[model samples]
Target: MDNRSYFLEEQRCVKKNGSQEISAHCDEELHFDIPPTAAWGTTEVQLREDLTEERQETLEDTANAFQGRGRVVRNNTHFCALTSCPRILQNKKKGKMGVTFRNSASEGSIFIGKRTVKDGECCGVWDVAGKYSIIMGPQRKWMMFSRFIFMDRLIADSHQYLEVRYRNGKKENKRGPLSMFEDPIVHESIAVMNAVTVDAFEVIVVYSEDEHGNVKRNVVHGPTVFIPDVNQWLHVFRWHGSRGKDLHEKVPGALVFTKLRTIPDQFYYNAEGVRTADDTSLTVKVMVFFQLTNLEVMLNSTHDPIGDFINALLADLMNFGCSYSYEQFVQNAQQLSELDTFPVMCGRASAIGFTIGKVVYRGYAASTQLQNLCESAIKTRTELKLKAEEQEQRERMRDYEVRGAHGRGDAERAEELAKQEHQLAMRAAQHQESLKQAEDAHSKALRQKEQMAQVELAAKVAEEQAHLAYLQGLKDMGVDLTQYLVSKSEKQPDKVLKVVTAPSHFSALPINSVSHIGGLNIHTNV
Candidate 1:
């Protein structure tokens, strides 16, 4: 057979030797053969606003698993009376043991109530469970408040604490008939709550002192820091809030925040009662920018830091203006830029916790009579320069025309030489051709003369052959042909006859009566 036994984490079983032993906090059952007597009990403990989840559970028994446990703490209800601040609520718990509120500045814890806690006891033991209420108070010196309450209940339930703190000179005032229960305010260095938020343009300086007793500084730029009391280990220094606009009144020992930005339209000056290098006076307007830097150091250094910076800037500008003539300054007025002013202004402003950013020359103008004279001089100079340039250009044109005429003369001479050479070559070719034709004609004439002479000689030879043949024929016929011809010629006197008087019979009869000489004798005629 098995015997059943159960216990909780906050429960401790007492033995005969007075030593104690604790049990598991879960719903586990142990089997014991002897079935020794067992009793259930609880511990009484105080939970601060910042206690962790694991540590809080150690102060409770296994009875915490019961439904609706530890729900009656007041500060845990998410109640805040700072009317200027907005609240955002999100309920994330589920089932019967759900969380209904949330706030970082104030918090609460659960309890198994109706138990008397001893002075040095971290927890109290209880025989039976009872109703629980909230117990809340400040844990830092800067969190001290002279008059703090909500919905007619004491803010910290410290009536006796107020009277004690008031008599100690730690607080200036106390609230109501509940002043008898107060305690002295602490954390004079300053404490900030997580409920506070800082803007992007703002900065919070956590001022304190080091171990050597000198002042120390910690900077917070925001967006925000969630917790401020966690940094109270250092001593107090100084605080400044909201550089842009007024947001909160001075809260003693609270984190002070402020911003850094440019202050515009600060320095507007008209240049007057000052003469330039040329003794010409002009009107000039200028502007500048100013910002805060080491504010804590500045307060101790000077009563009016901004005024000192402005005066130094104007004095330096006056000196710079004297270095340039009226025309020179107006022509290149932009030379009076930020680079020229920052160095001089910063030198004087460093003692006042201010920084110089930019300087600008807005505008400038001269007197009307002086401006007219300047304009006339400028126009005259421009006209003279134009006339000189025109004369130079005319000289260049004359030189070009002369060069062009010389080039045309050289080209014409070359063309004439080429024409003469061509004419000489054509004449030479014509002379050679005429000489060849004359030679050909002379040769033809000589050939024609020789041909005519040959034709005449051939004709003479043919006539002589004919004559000889004729004479032979007459001889062959045995006729006296010469004599016949002579007789024939004698009958025709116009015909001439040549006679060879080798004197044969033909010659002998050549006398005038040869008519009958060959046949009949002519004795009577003789």
Candidate 2:
């Protein structure tokens, strides 16, 4: 028979061996070519007898018989068996297939002719024989078969973990460096978590739930990694300030002060429209440096430490502006660097667990009019100072000139006095030498006169003795001594003339009596 255009109905009755009747459906396509000997019957006994004779025949004879009739039995089934039996399914690979029953009301359960198969229970091929129905079957019940879901092995690293949730609403944490086969019972995997790592200078604050369900906090200091428990959470710090607005908005987690090292922050404060003691308005700019000291105290005390510092510094600067005059403030501007100037800031920092390291007075600005006036005053004062300095310098120069003139005069006077003293010394030496020469000449003349006188006296004494002896011989035949003296004076006429010019009247006594004249005392009376 050619069954190419034949389609089965919802409830089709087929007669087996011309006697037995059966209601059935065929899900697969049916195409058949059968010989006259392999035709169907209306009776079950005839169907069974035909199937036994076909099985007893040789395969080539059956195929030749079908070929002679211009038809072929592809599945080797006789026409009577095709209309009475259901199809069979087989698995030849390593995976699972899902067989869902259209008539079963519960999940993973199926109903056979007289038995039931539930979940987690194994079913043999025979148990599922009539349980699977086709879409066009007598009951119109359809079975849906799912494709294979391959079993695979999962691996996790040391820093990774898996969160598994079951069909029963139970959760489990699977941490690794390990490999595990996928359990058939697990429903799904929720997430994969990696460990948080920190350096030696950092720490992490974590909040977790305890066994009693109470929330607890802890600090983790590292050079290490931190793997949080399934129920634990990390602490996030949020800070807001004028300087940090954009930074905080973009990366809020960066403000979490995990570092244990010292941190420095700067804030600028402008105290505007402040009135000085002299009623002068001023605007002062002050910069502040601050650091965090104790994290525990900070968390317990305040939410925004930078904001607190800014407010406190502004308050202190305003107070200072109100207390001092412009000049006083400028003169004592260095006082801002001292911690004592920021009492409010210091107190607030201590309360909020921060340390105020230093404050800097970034000078000040005033209204345009006030600035111009101050500049004018400064210019006038500077001009006056310059003029005074110039006059002082001129006076100094005049004094120097006068001093130089006086010094030159004194030097000239000193030189003149030195020259006069030298001349006087030379004159005194020359006078001394002349006096010595005169005294030496006088002494030599006196010595010569004395020697001449001594010689004359000796000669006179010798002559007088010789004359006496001659007189004694003249008394017995000698000449007179007076005649000898006259003869000696007559030989020297210049001596006679000197005697004549003598202060005595000895010229009148005659040459013969001139013995008493020329420094010779002869006892001759005339």
Candidate 3:
């Protein structure tokens, strides 16, 4: 690893026919129509004359072989149809700006020209020439990052040092040994983006290290499932998706992936025992929406502040909960995801969590492989969350009291209300349990239906295989089914010529269709 710090940059380029062949050699000769070295993610940018242009690095998603008759799909709204995308195509049509993970957009046209730039600024622009989103469907992804690289010189490395590290708590007292998730496992170079919230959010420290074992922690979240602060997480709600078969599932058809949490409309928080706004006895039921995304995680309360803010407030309130357990993590996610409030009896207790810090996003050289890492992060988040919940339940049975200034008598009436509030909450919890059971049943039914469909598909494929075998057997016996099935008055028909002009083109051939082709289909050209 180089002792000096290295800056990773992402750039955009479009490859066209007759252009220099770009196999795996994109690192050597690449032309950038819009080098947003100073444009992407910067507050201000000006082109450099006194300074040298920044050298950016972009990982190759798909290799360049030649394929003819490529068509462009514009304005595809779905995204999942693009996920698991085997590869992305490079379109080098002049006047056609290409789509890329690096953000670069023109001030005039979406795909026309480069926006203005400054020397030290890394431009945050969208690669907008309507490239299809493989996993997300036809909707292409725009570039998002904290910064880009500025270079005075370009020194190509046969292999540069890239490492990944993870930290659970504060940066000052970082814990754990550095682990590497590299090459095909961690595609798409690491880039940083700013988070809106700075308070107590759960943060993971991540970054690539150099070959010399020198480590850098620029990335805060990689393979981390938990996102703190609803206000900062960037999220997409819904999109379409495609399958393994070459058919568009969403319209203009494609696979789509959407972020569910970023921009929630409303947040729900329970207001069980809090005093009314007027200080008189008042009952209020409200929905609290705790919205989170790649940028922000914010809390919005309805009439009941406790309903909306409790989960976040509890992070500061109940500090005894452990992070190692799933119950704690889930209780945190639920409390955070749910709404909560305050101004209750000191004796009353509620489990809550907060936004300790930032969670980073990282991937292998190929973004597709990130799914395995993503799946692991997701599972870890869920399991730990569940453990936290069970621990919270045990805490409920404990009793405690706090002094309210100068030995003054605590409000007995308030204490009574708090006890009843706990009972009310217990009843509500029962109802929630019932709701969960119904959901489980519904999910099971869906799984069964899907399994049956797969079984039927397999049966059909197998039947087709058997029939093909029988046809070959007949051909081996010197019997030509095509001649046998021809018109009774006809002489030997030409076996070399084509018959039944059109054939089914359903990616995987339908075995049933072949059965209806009459005896002539049995004449296999063994």
Alpha-carbon TM-score of each model against the true structure: 0.27, 0.40, 0.15
Q: Kindly list the per-residue Cα lDDT of model 3 for residues 1-526, writing each as its tens digit.
A: 2122112123323322243322211122222222222121111111212211222112221112112222223333111110122232223122323332222221111222112233222232323443322122222223422222211111222222222222432111111222222111223332222222222343333334565767553324332443223112232222222345532122222323222232333422222322222232211233332333433222111222223343333332233223213324333333322223222311122212222121111111212344466578879988998889778755653422223332235567667788999999999999999999999999999999899998998998898888778778878999886875475446544343334433456435323322213325334422
lDDT of 2 by residue, 1-526 (tens): 2321122221232324435334343222222333335444221111122222112111112222232223333466433233321111112222222343222111232221112232332222212343322122122122223111112345568987766677787777778776543433454544566667777767678888988999988878777877777688787666543345432122222344433434566666666766777888887777778887787888789877766776777788778867888889778778878899889989999998889888888777899998998999999999999999999999999999999999999999999999999999999999999999999999999999999999999999999999778777766655566686677667433222223354465556653233444555354333
Point out where model 1 deviates above 4 Å.
Answer: 1-198, 203-273, 287-291, 302-306, 331-334, 338-343, 375-526
> Of models 1 and 2, which has the larger TM-score?
2
Candidate 1 per-residue lDDT, tens place, 408-449, comes to 998899899999999999999899889989999999999898
lDDT of each: 0.45, 0.57, 0.32
Tell me the RMSD of model 3 versus the true structure.
52.0
In terms of lDDT, model 1 sits at 0.45
RMSD of each: 25.5, 24.9, 52.0
Ten-residue stretch with the least lDDT total in model 2:
51-60
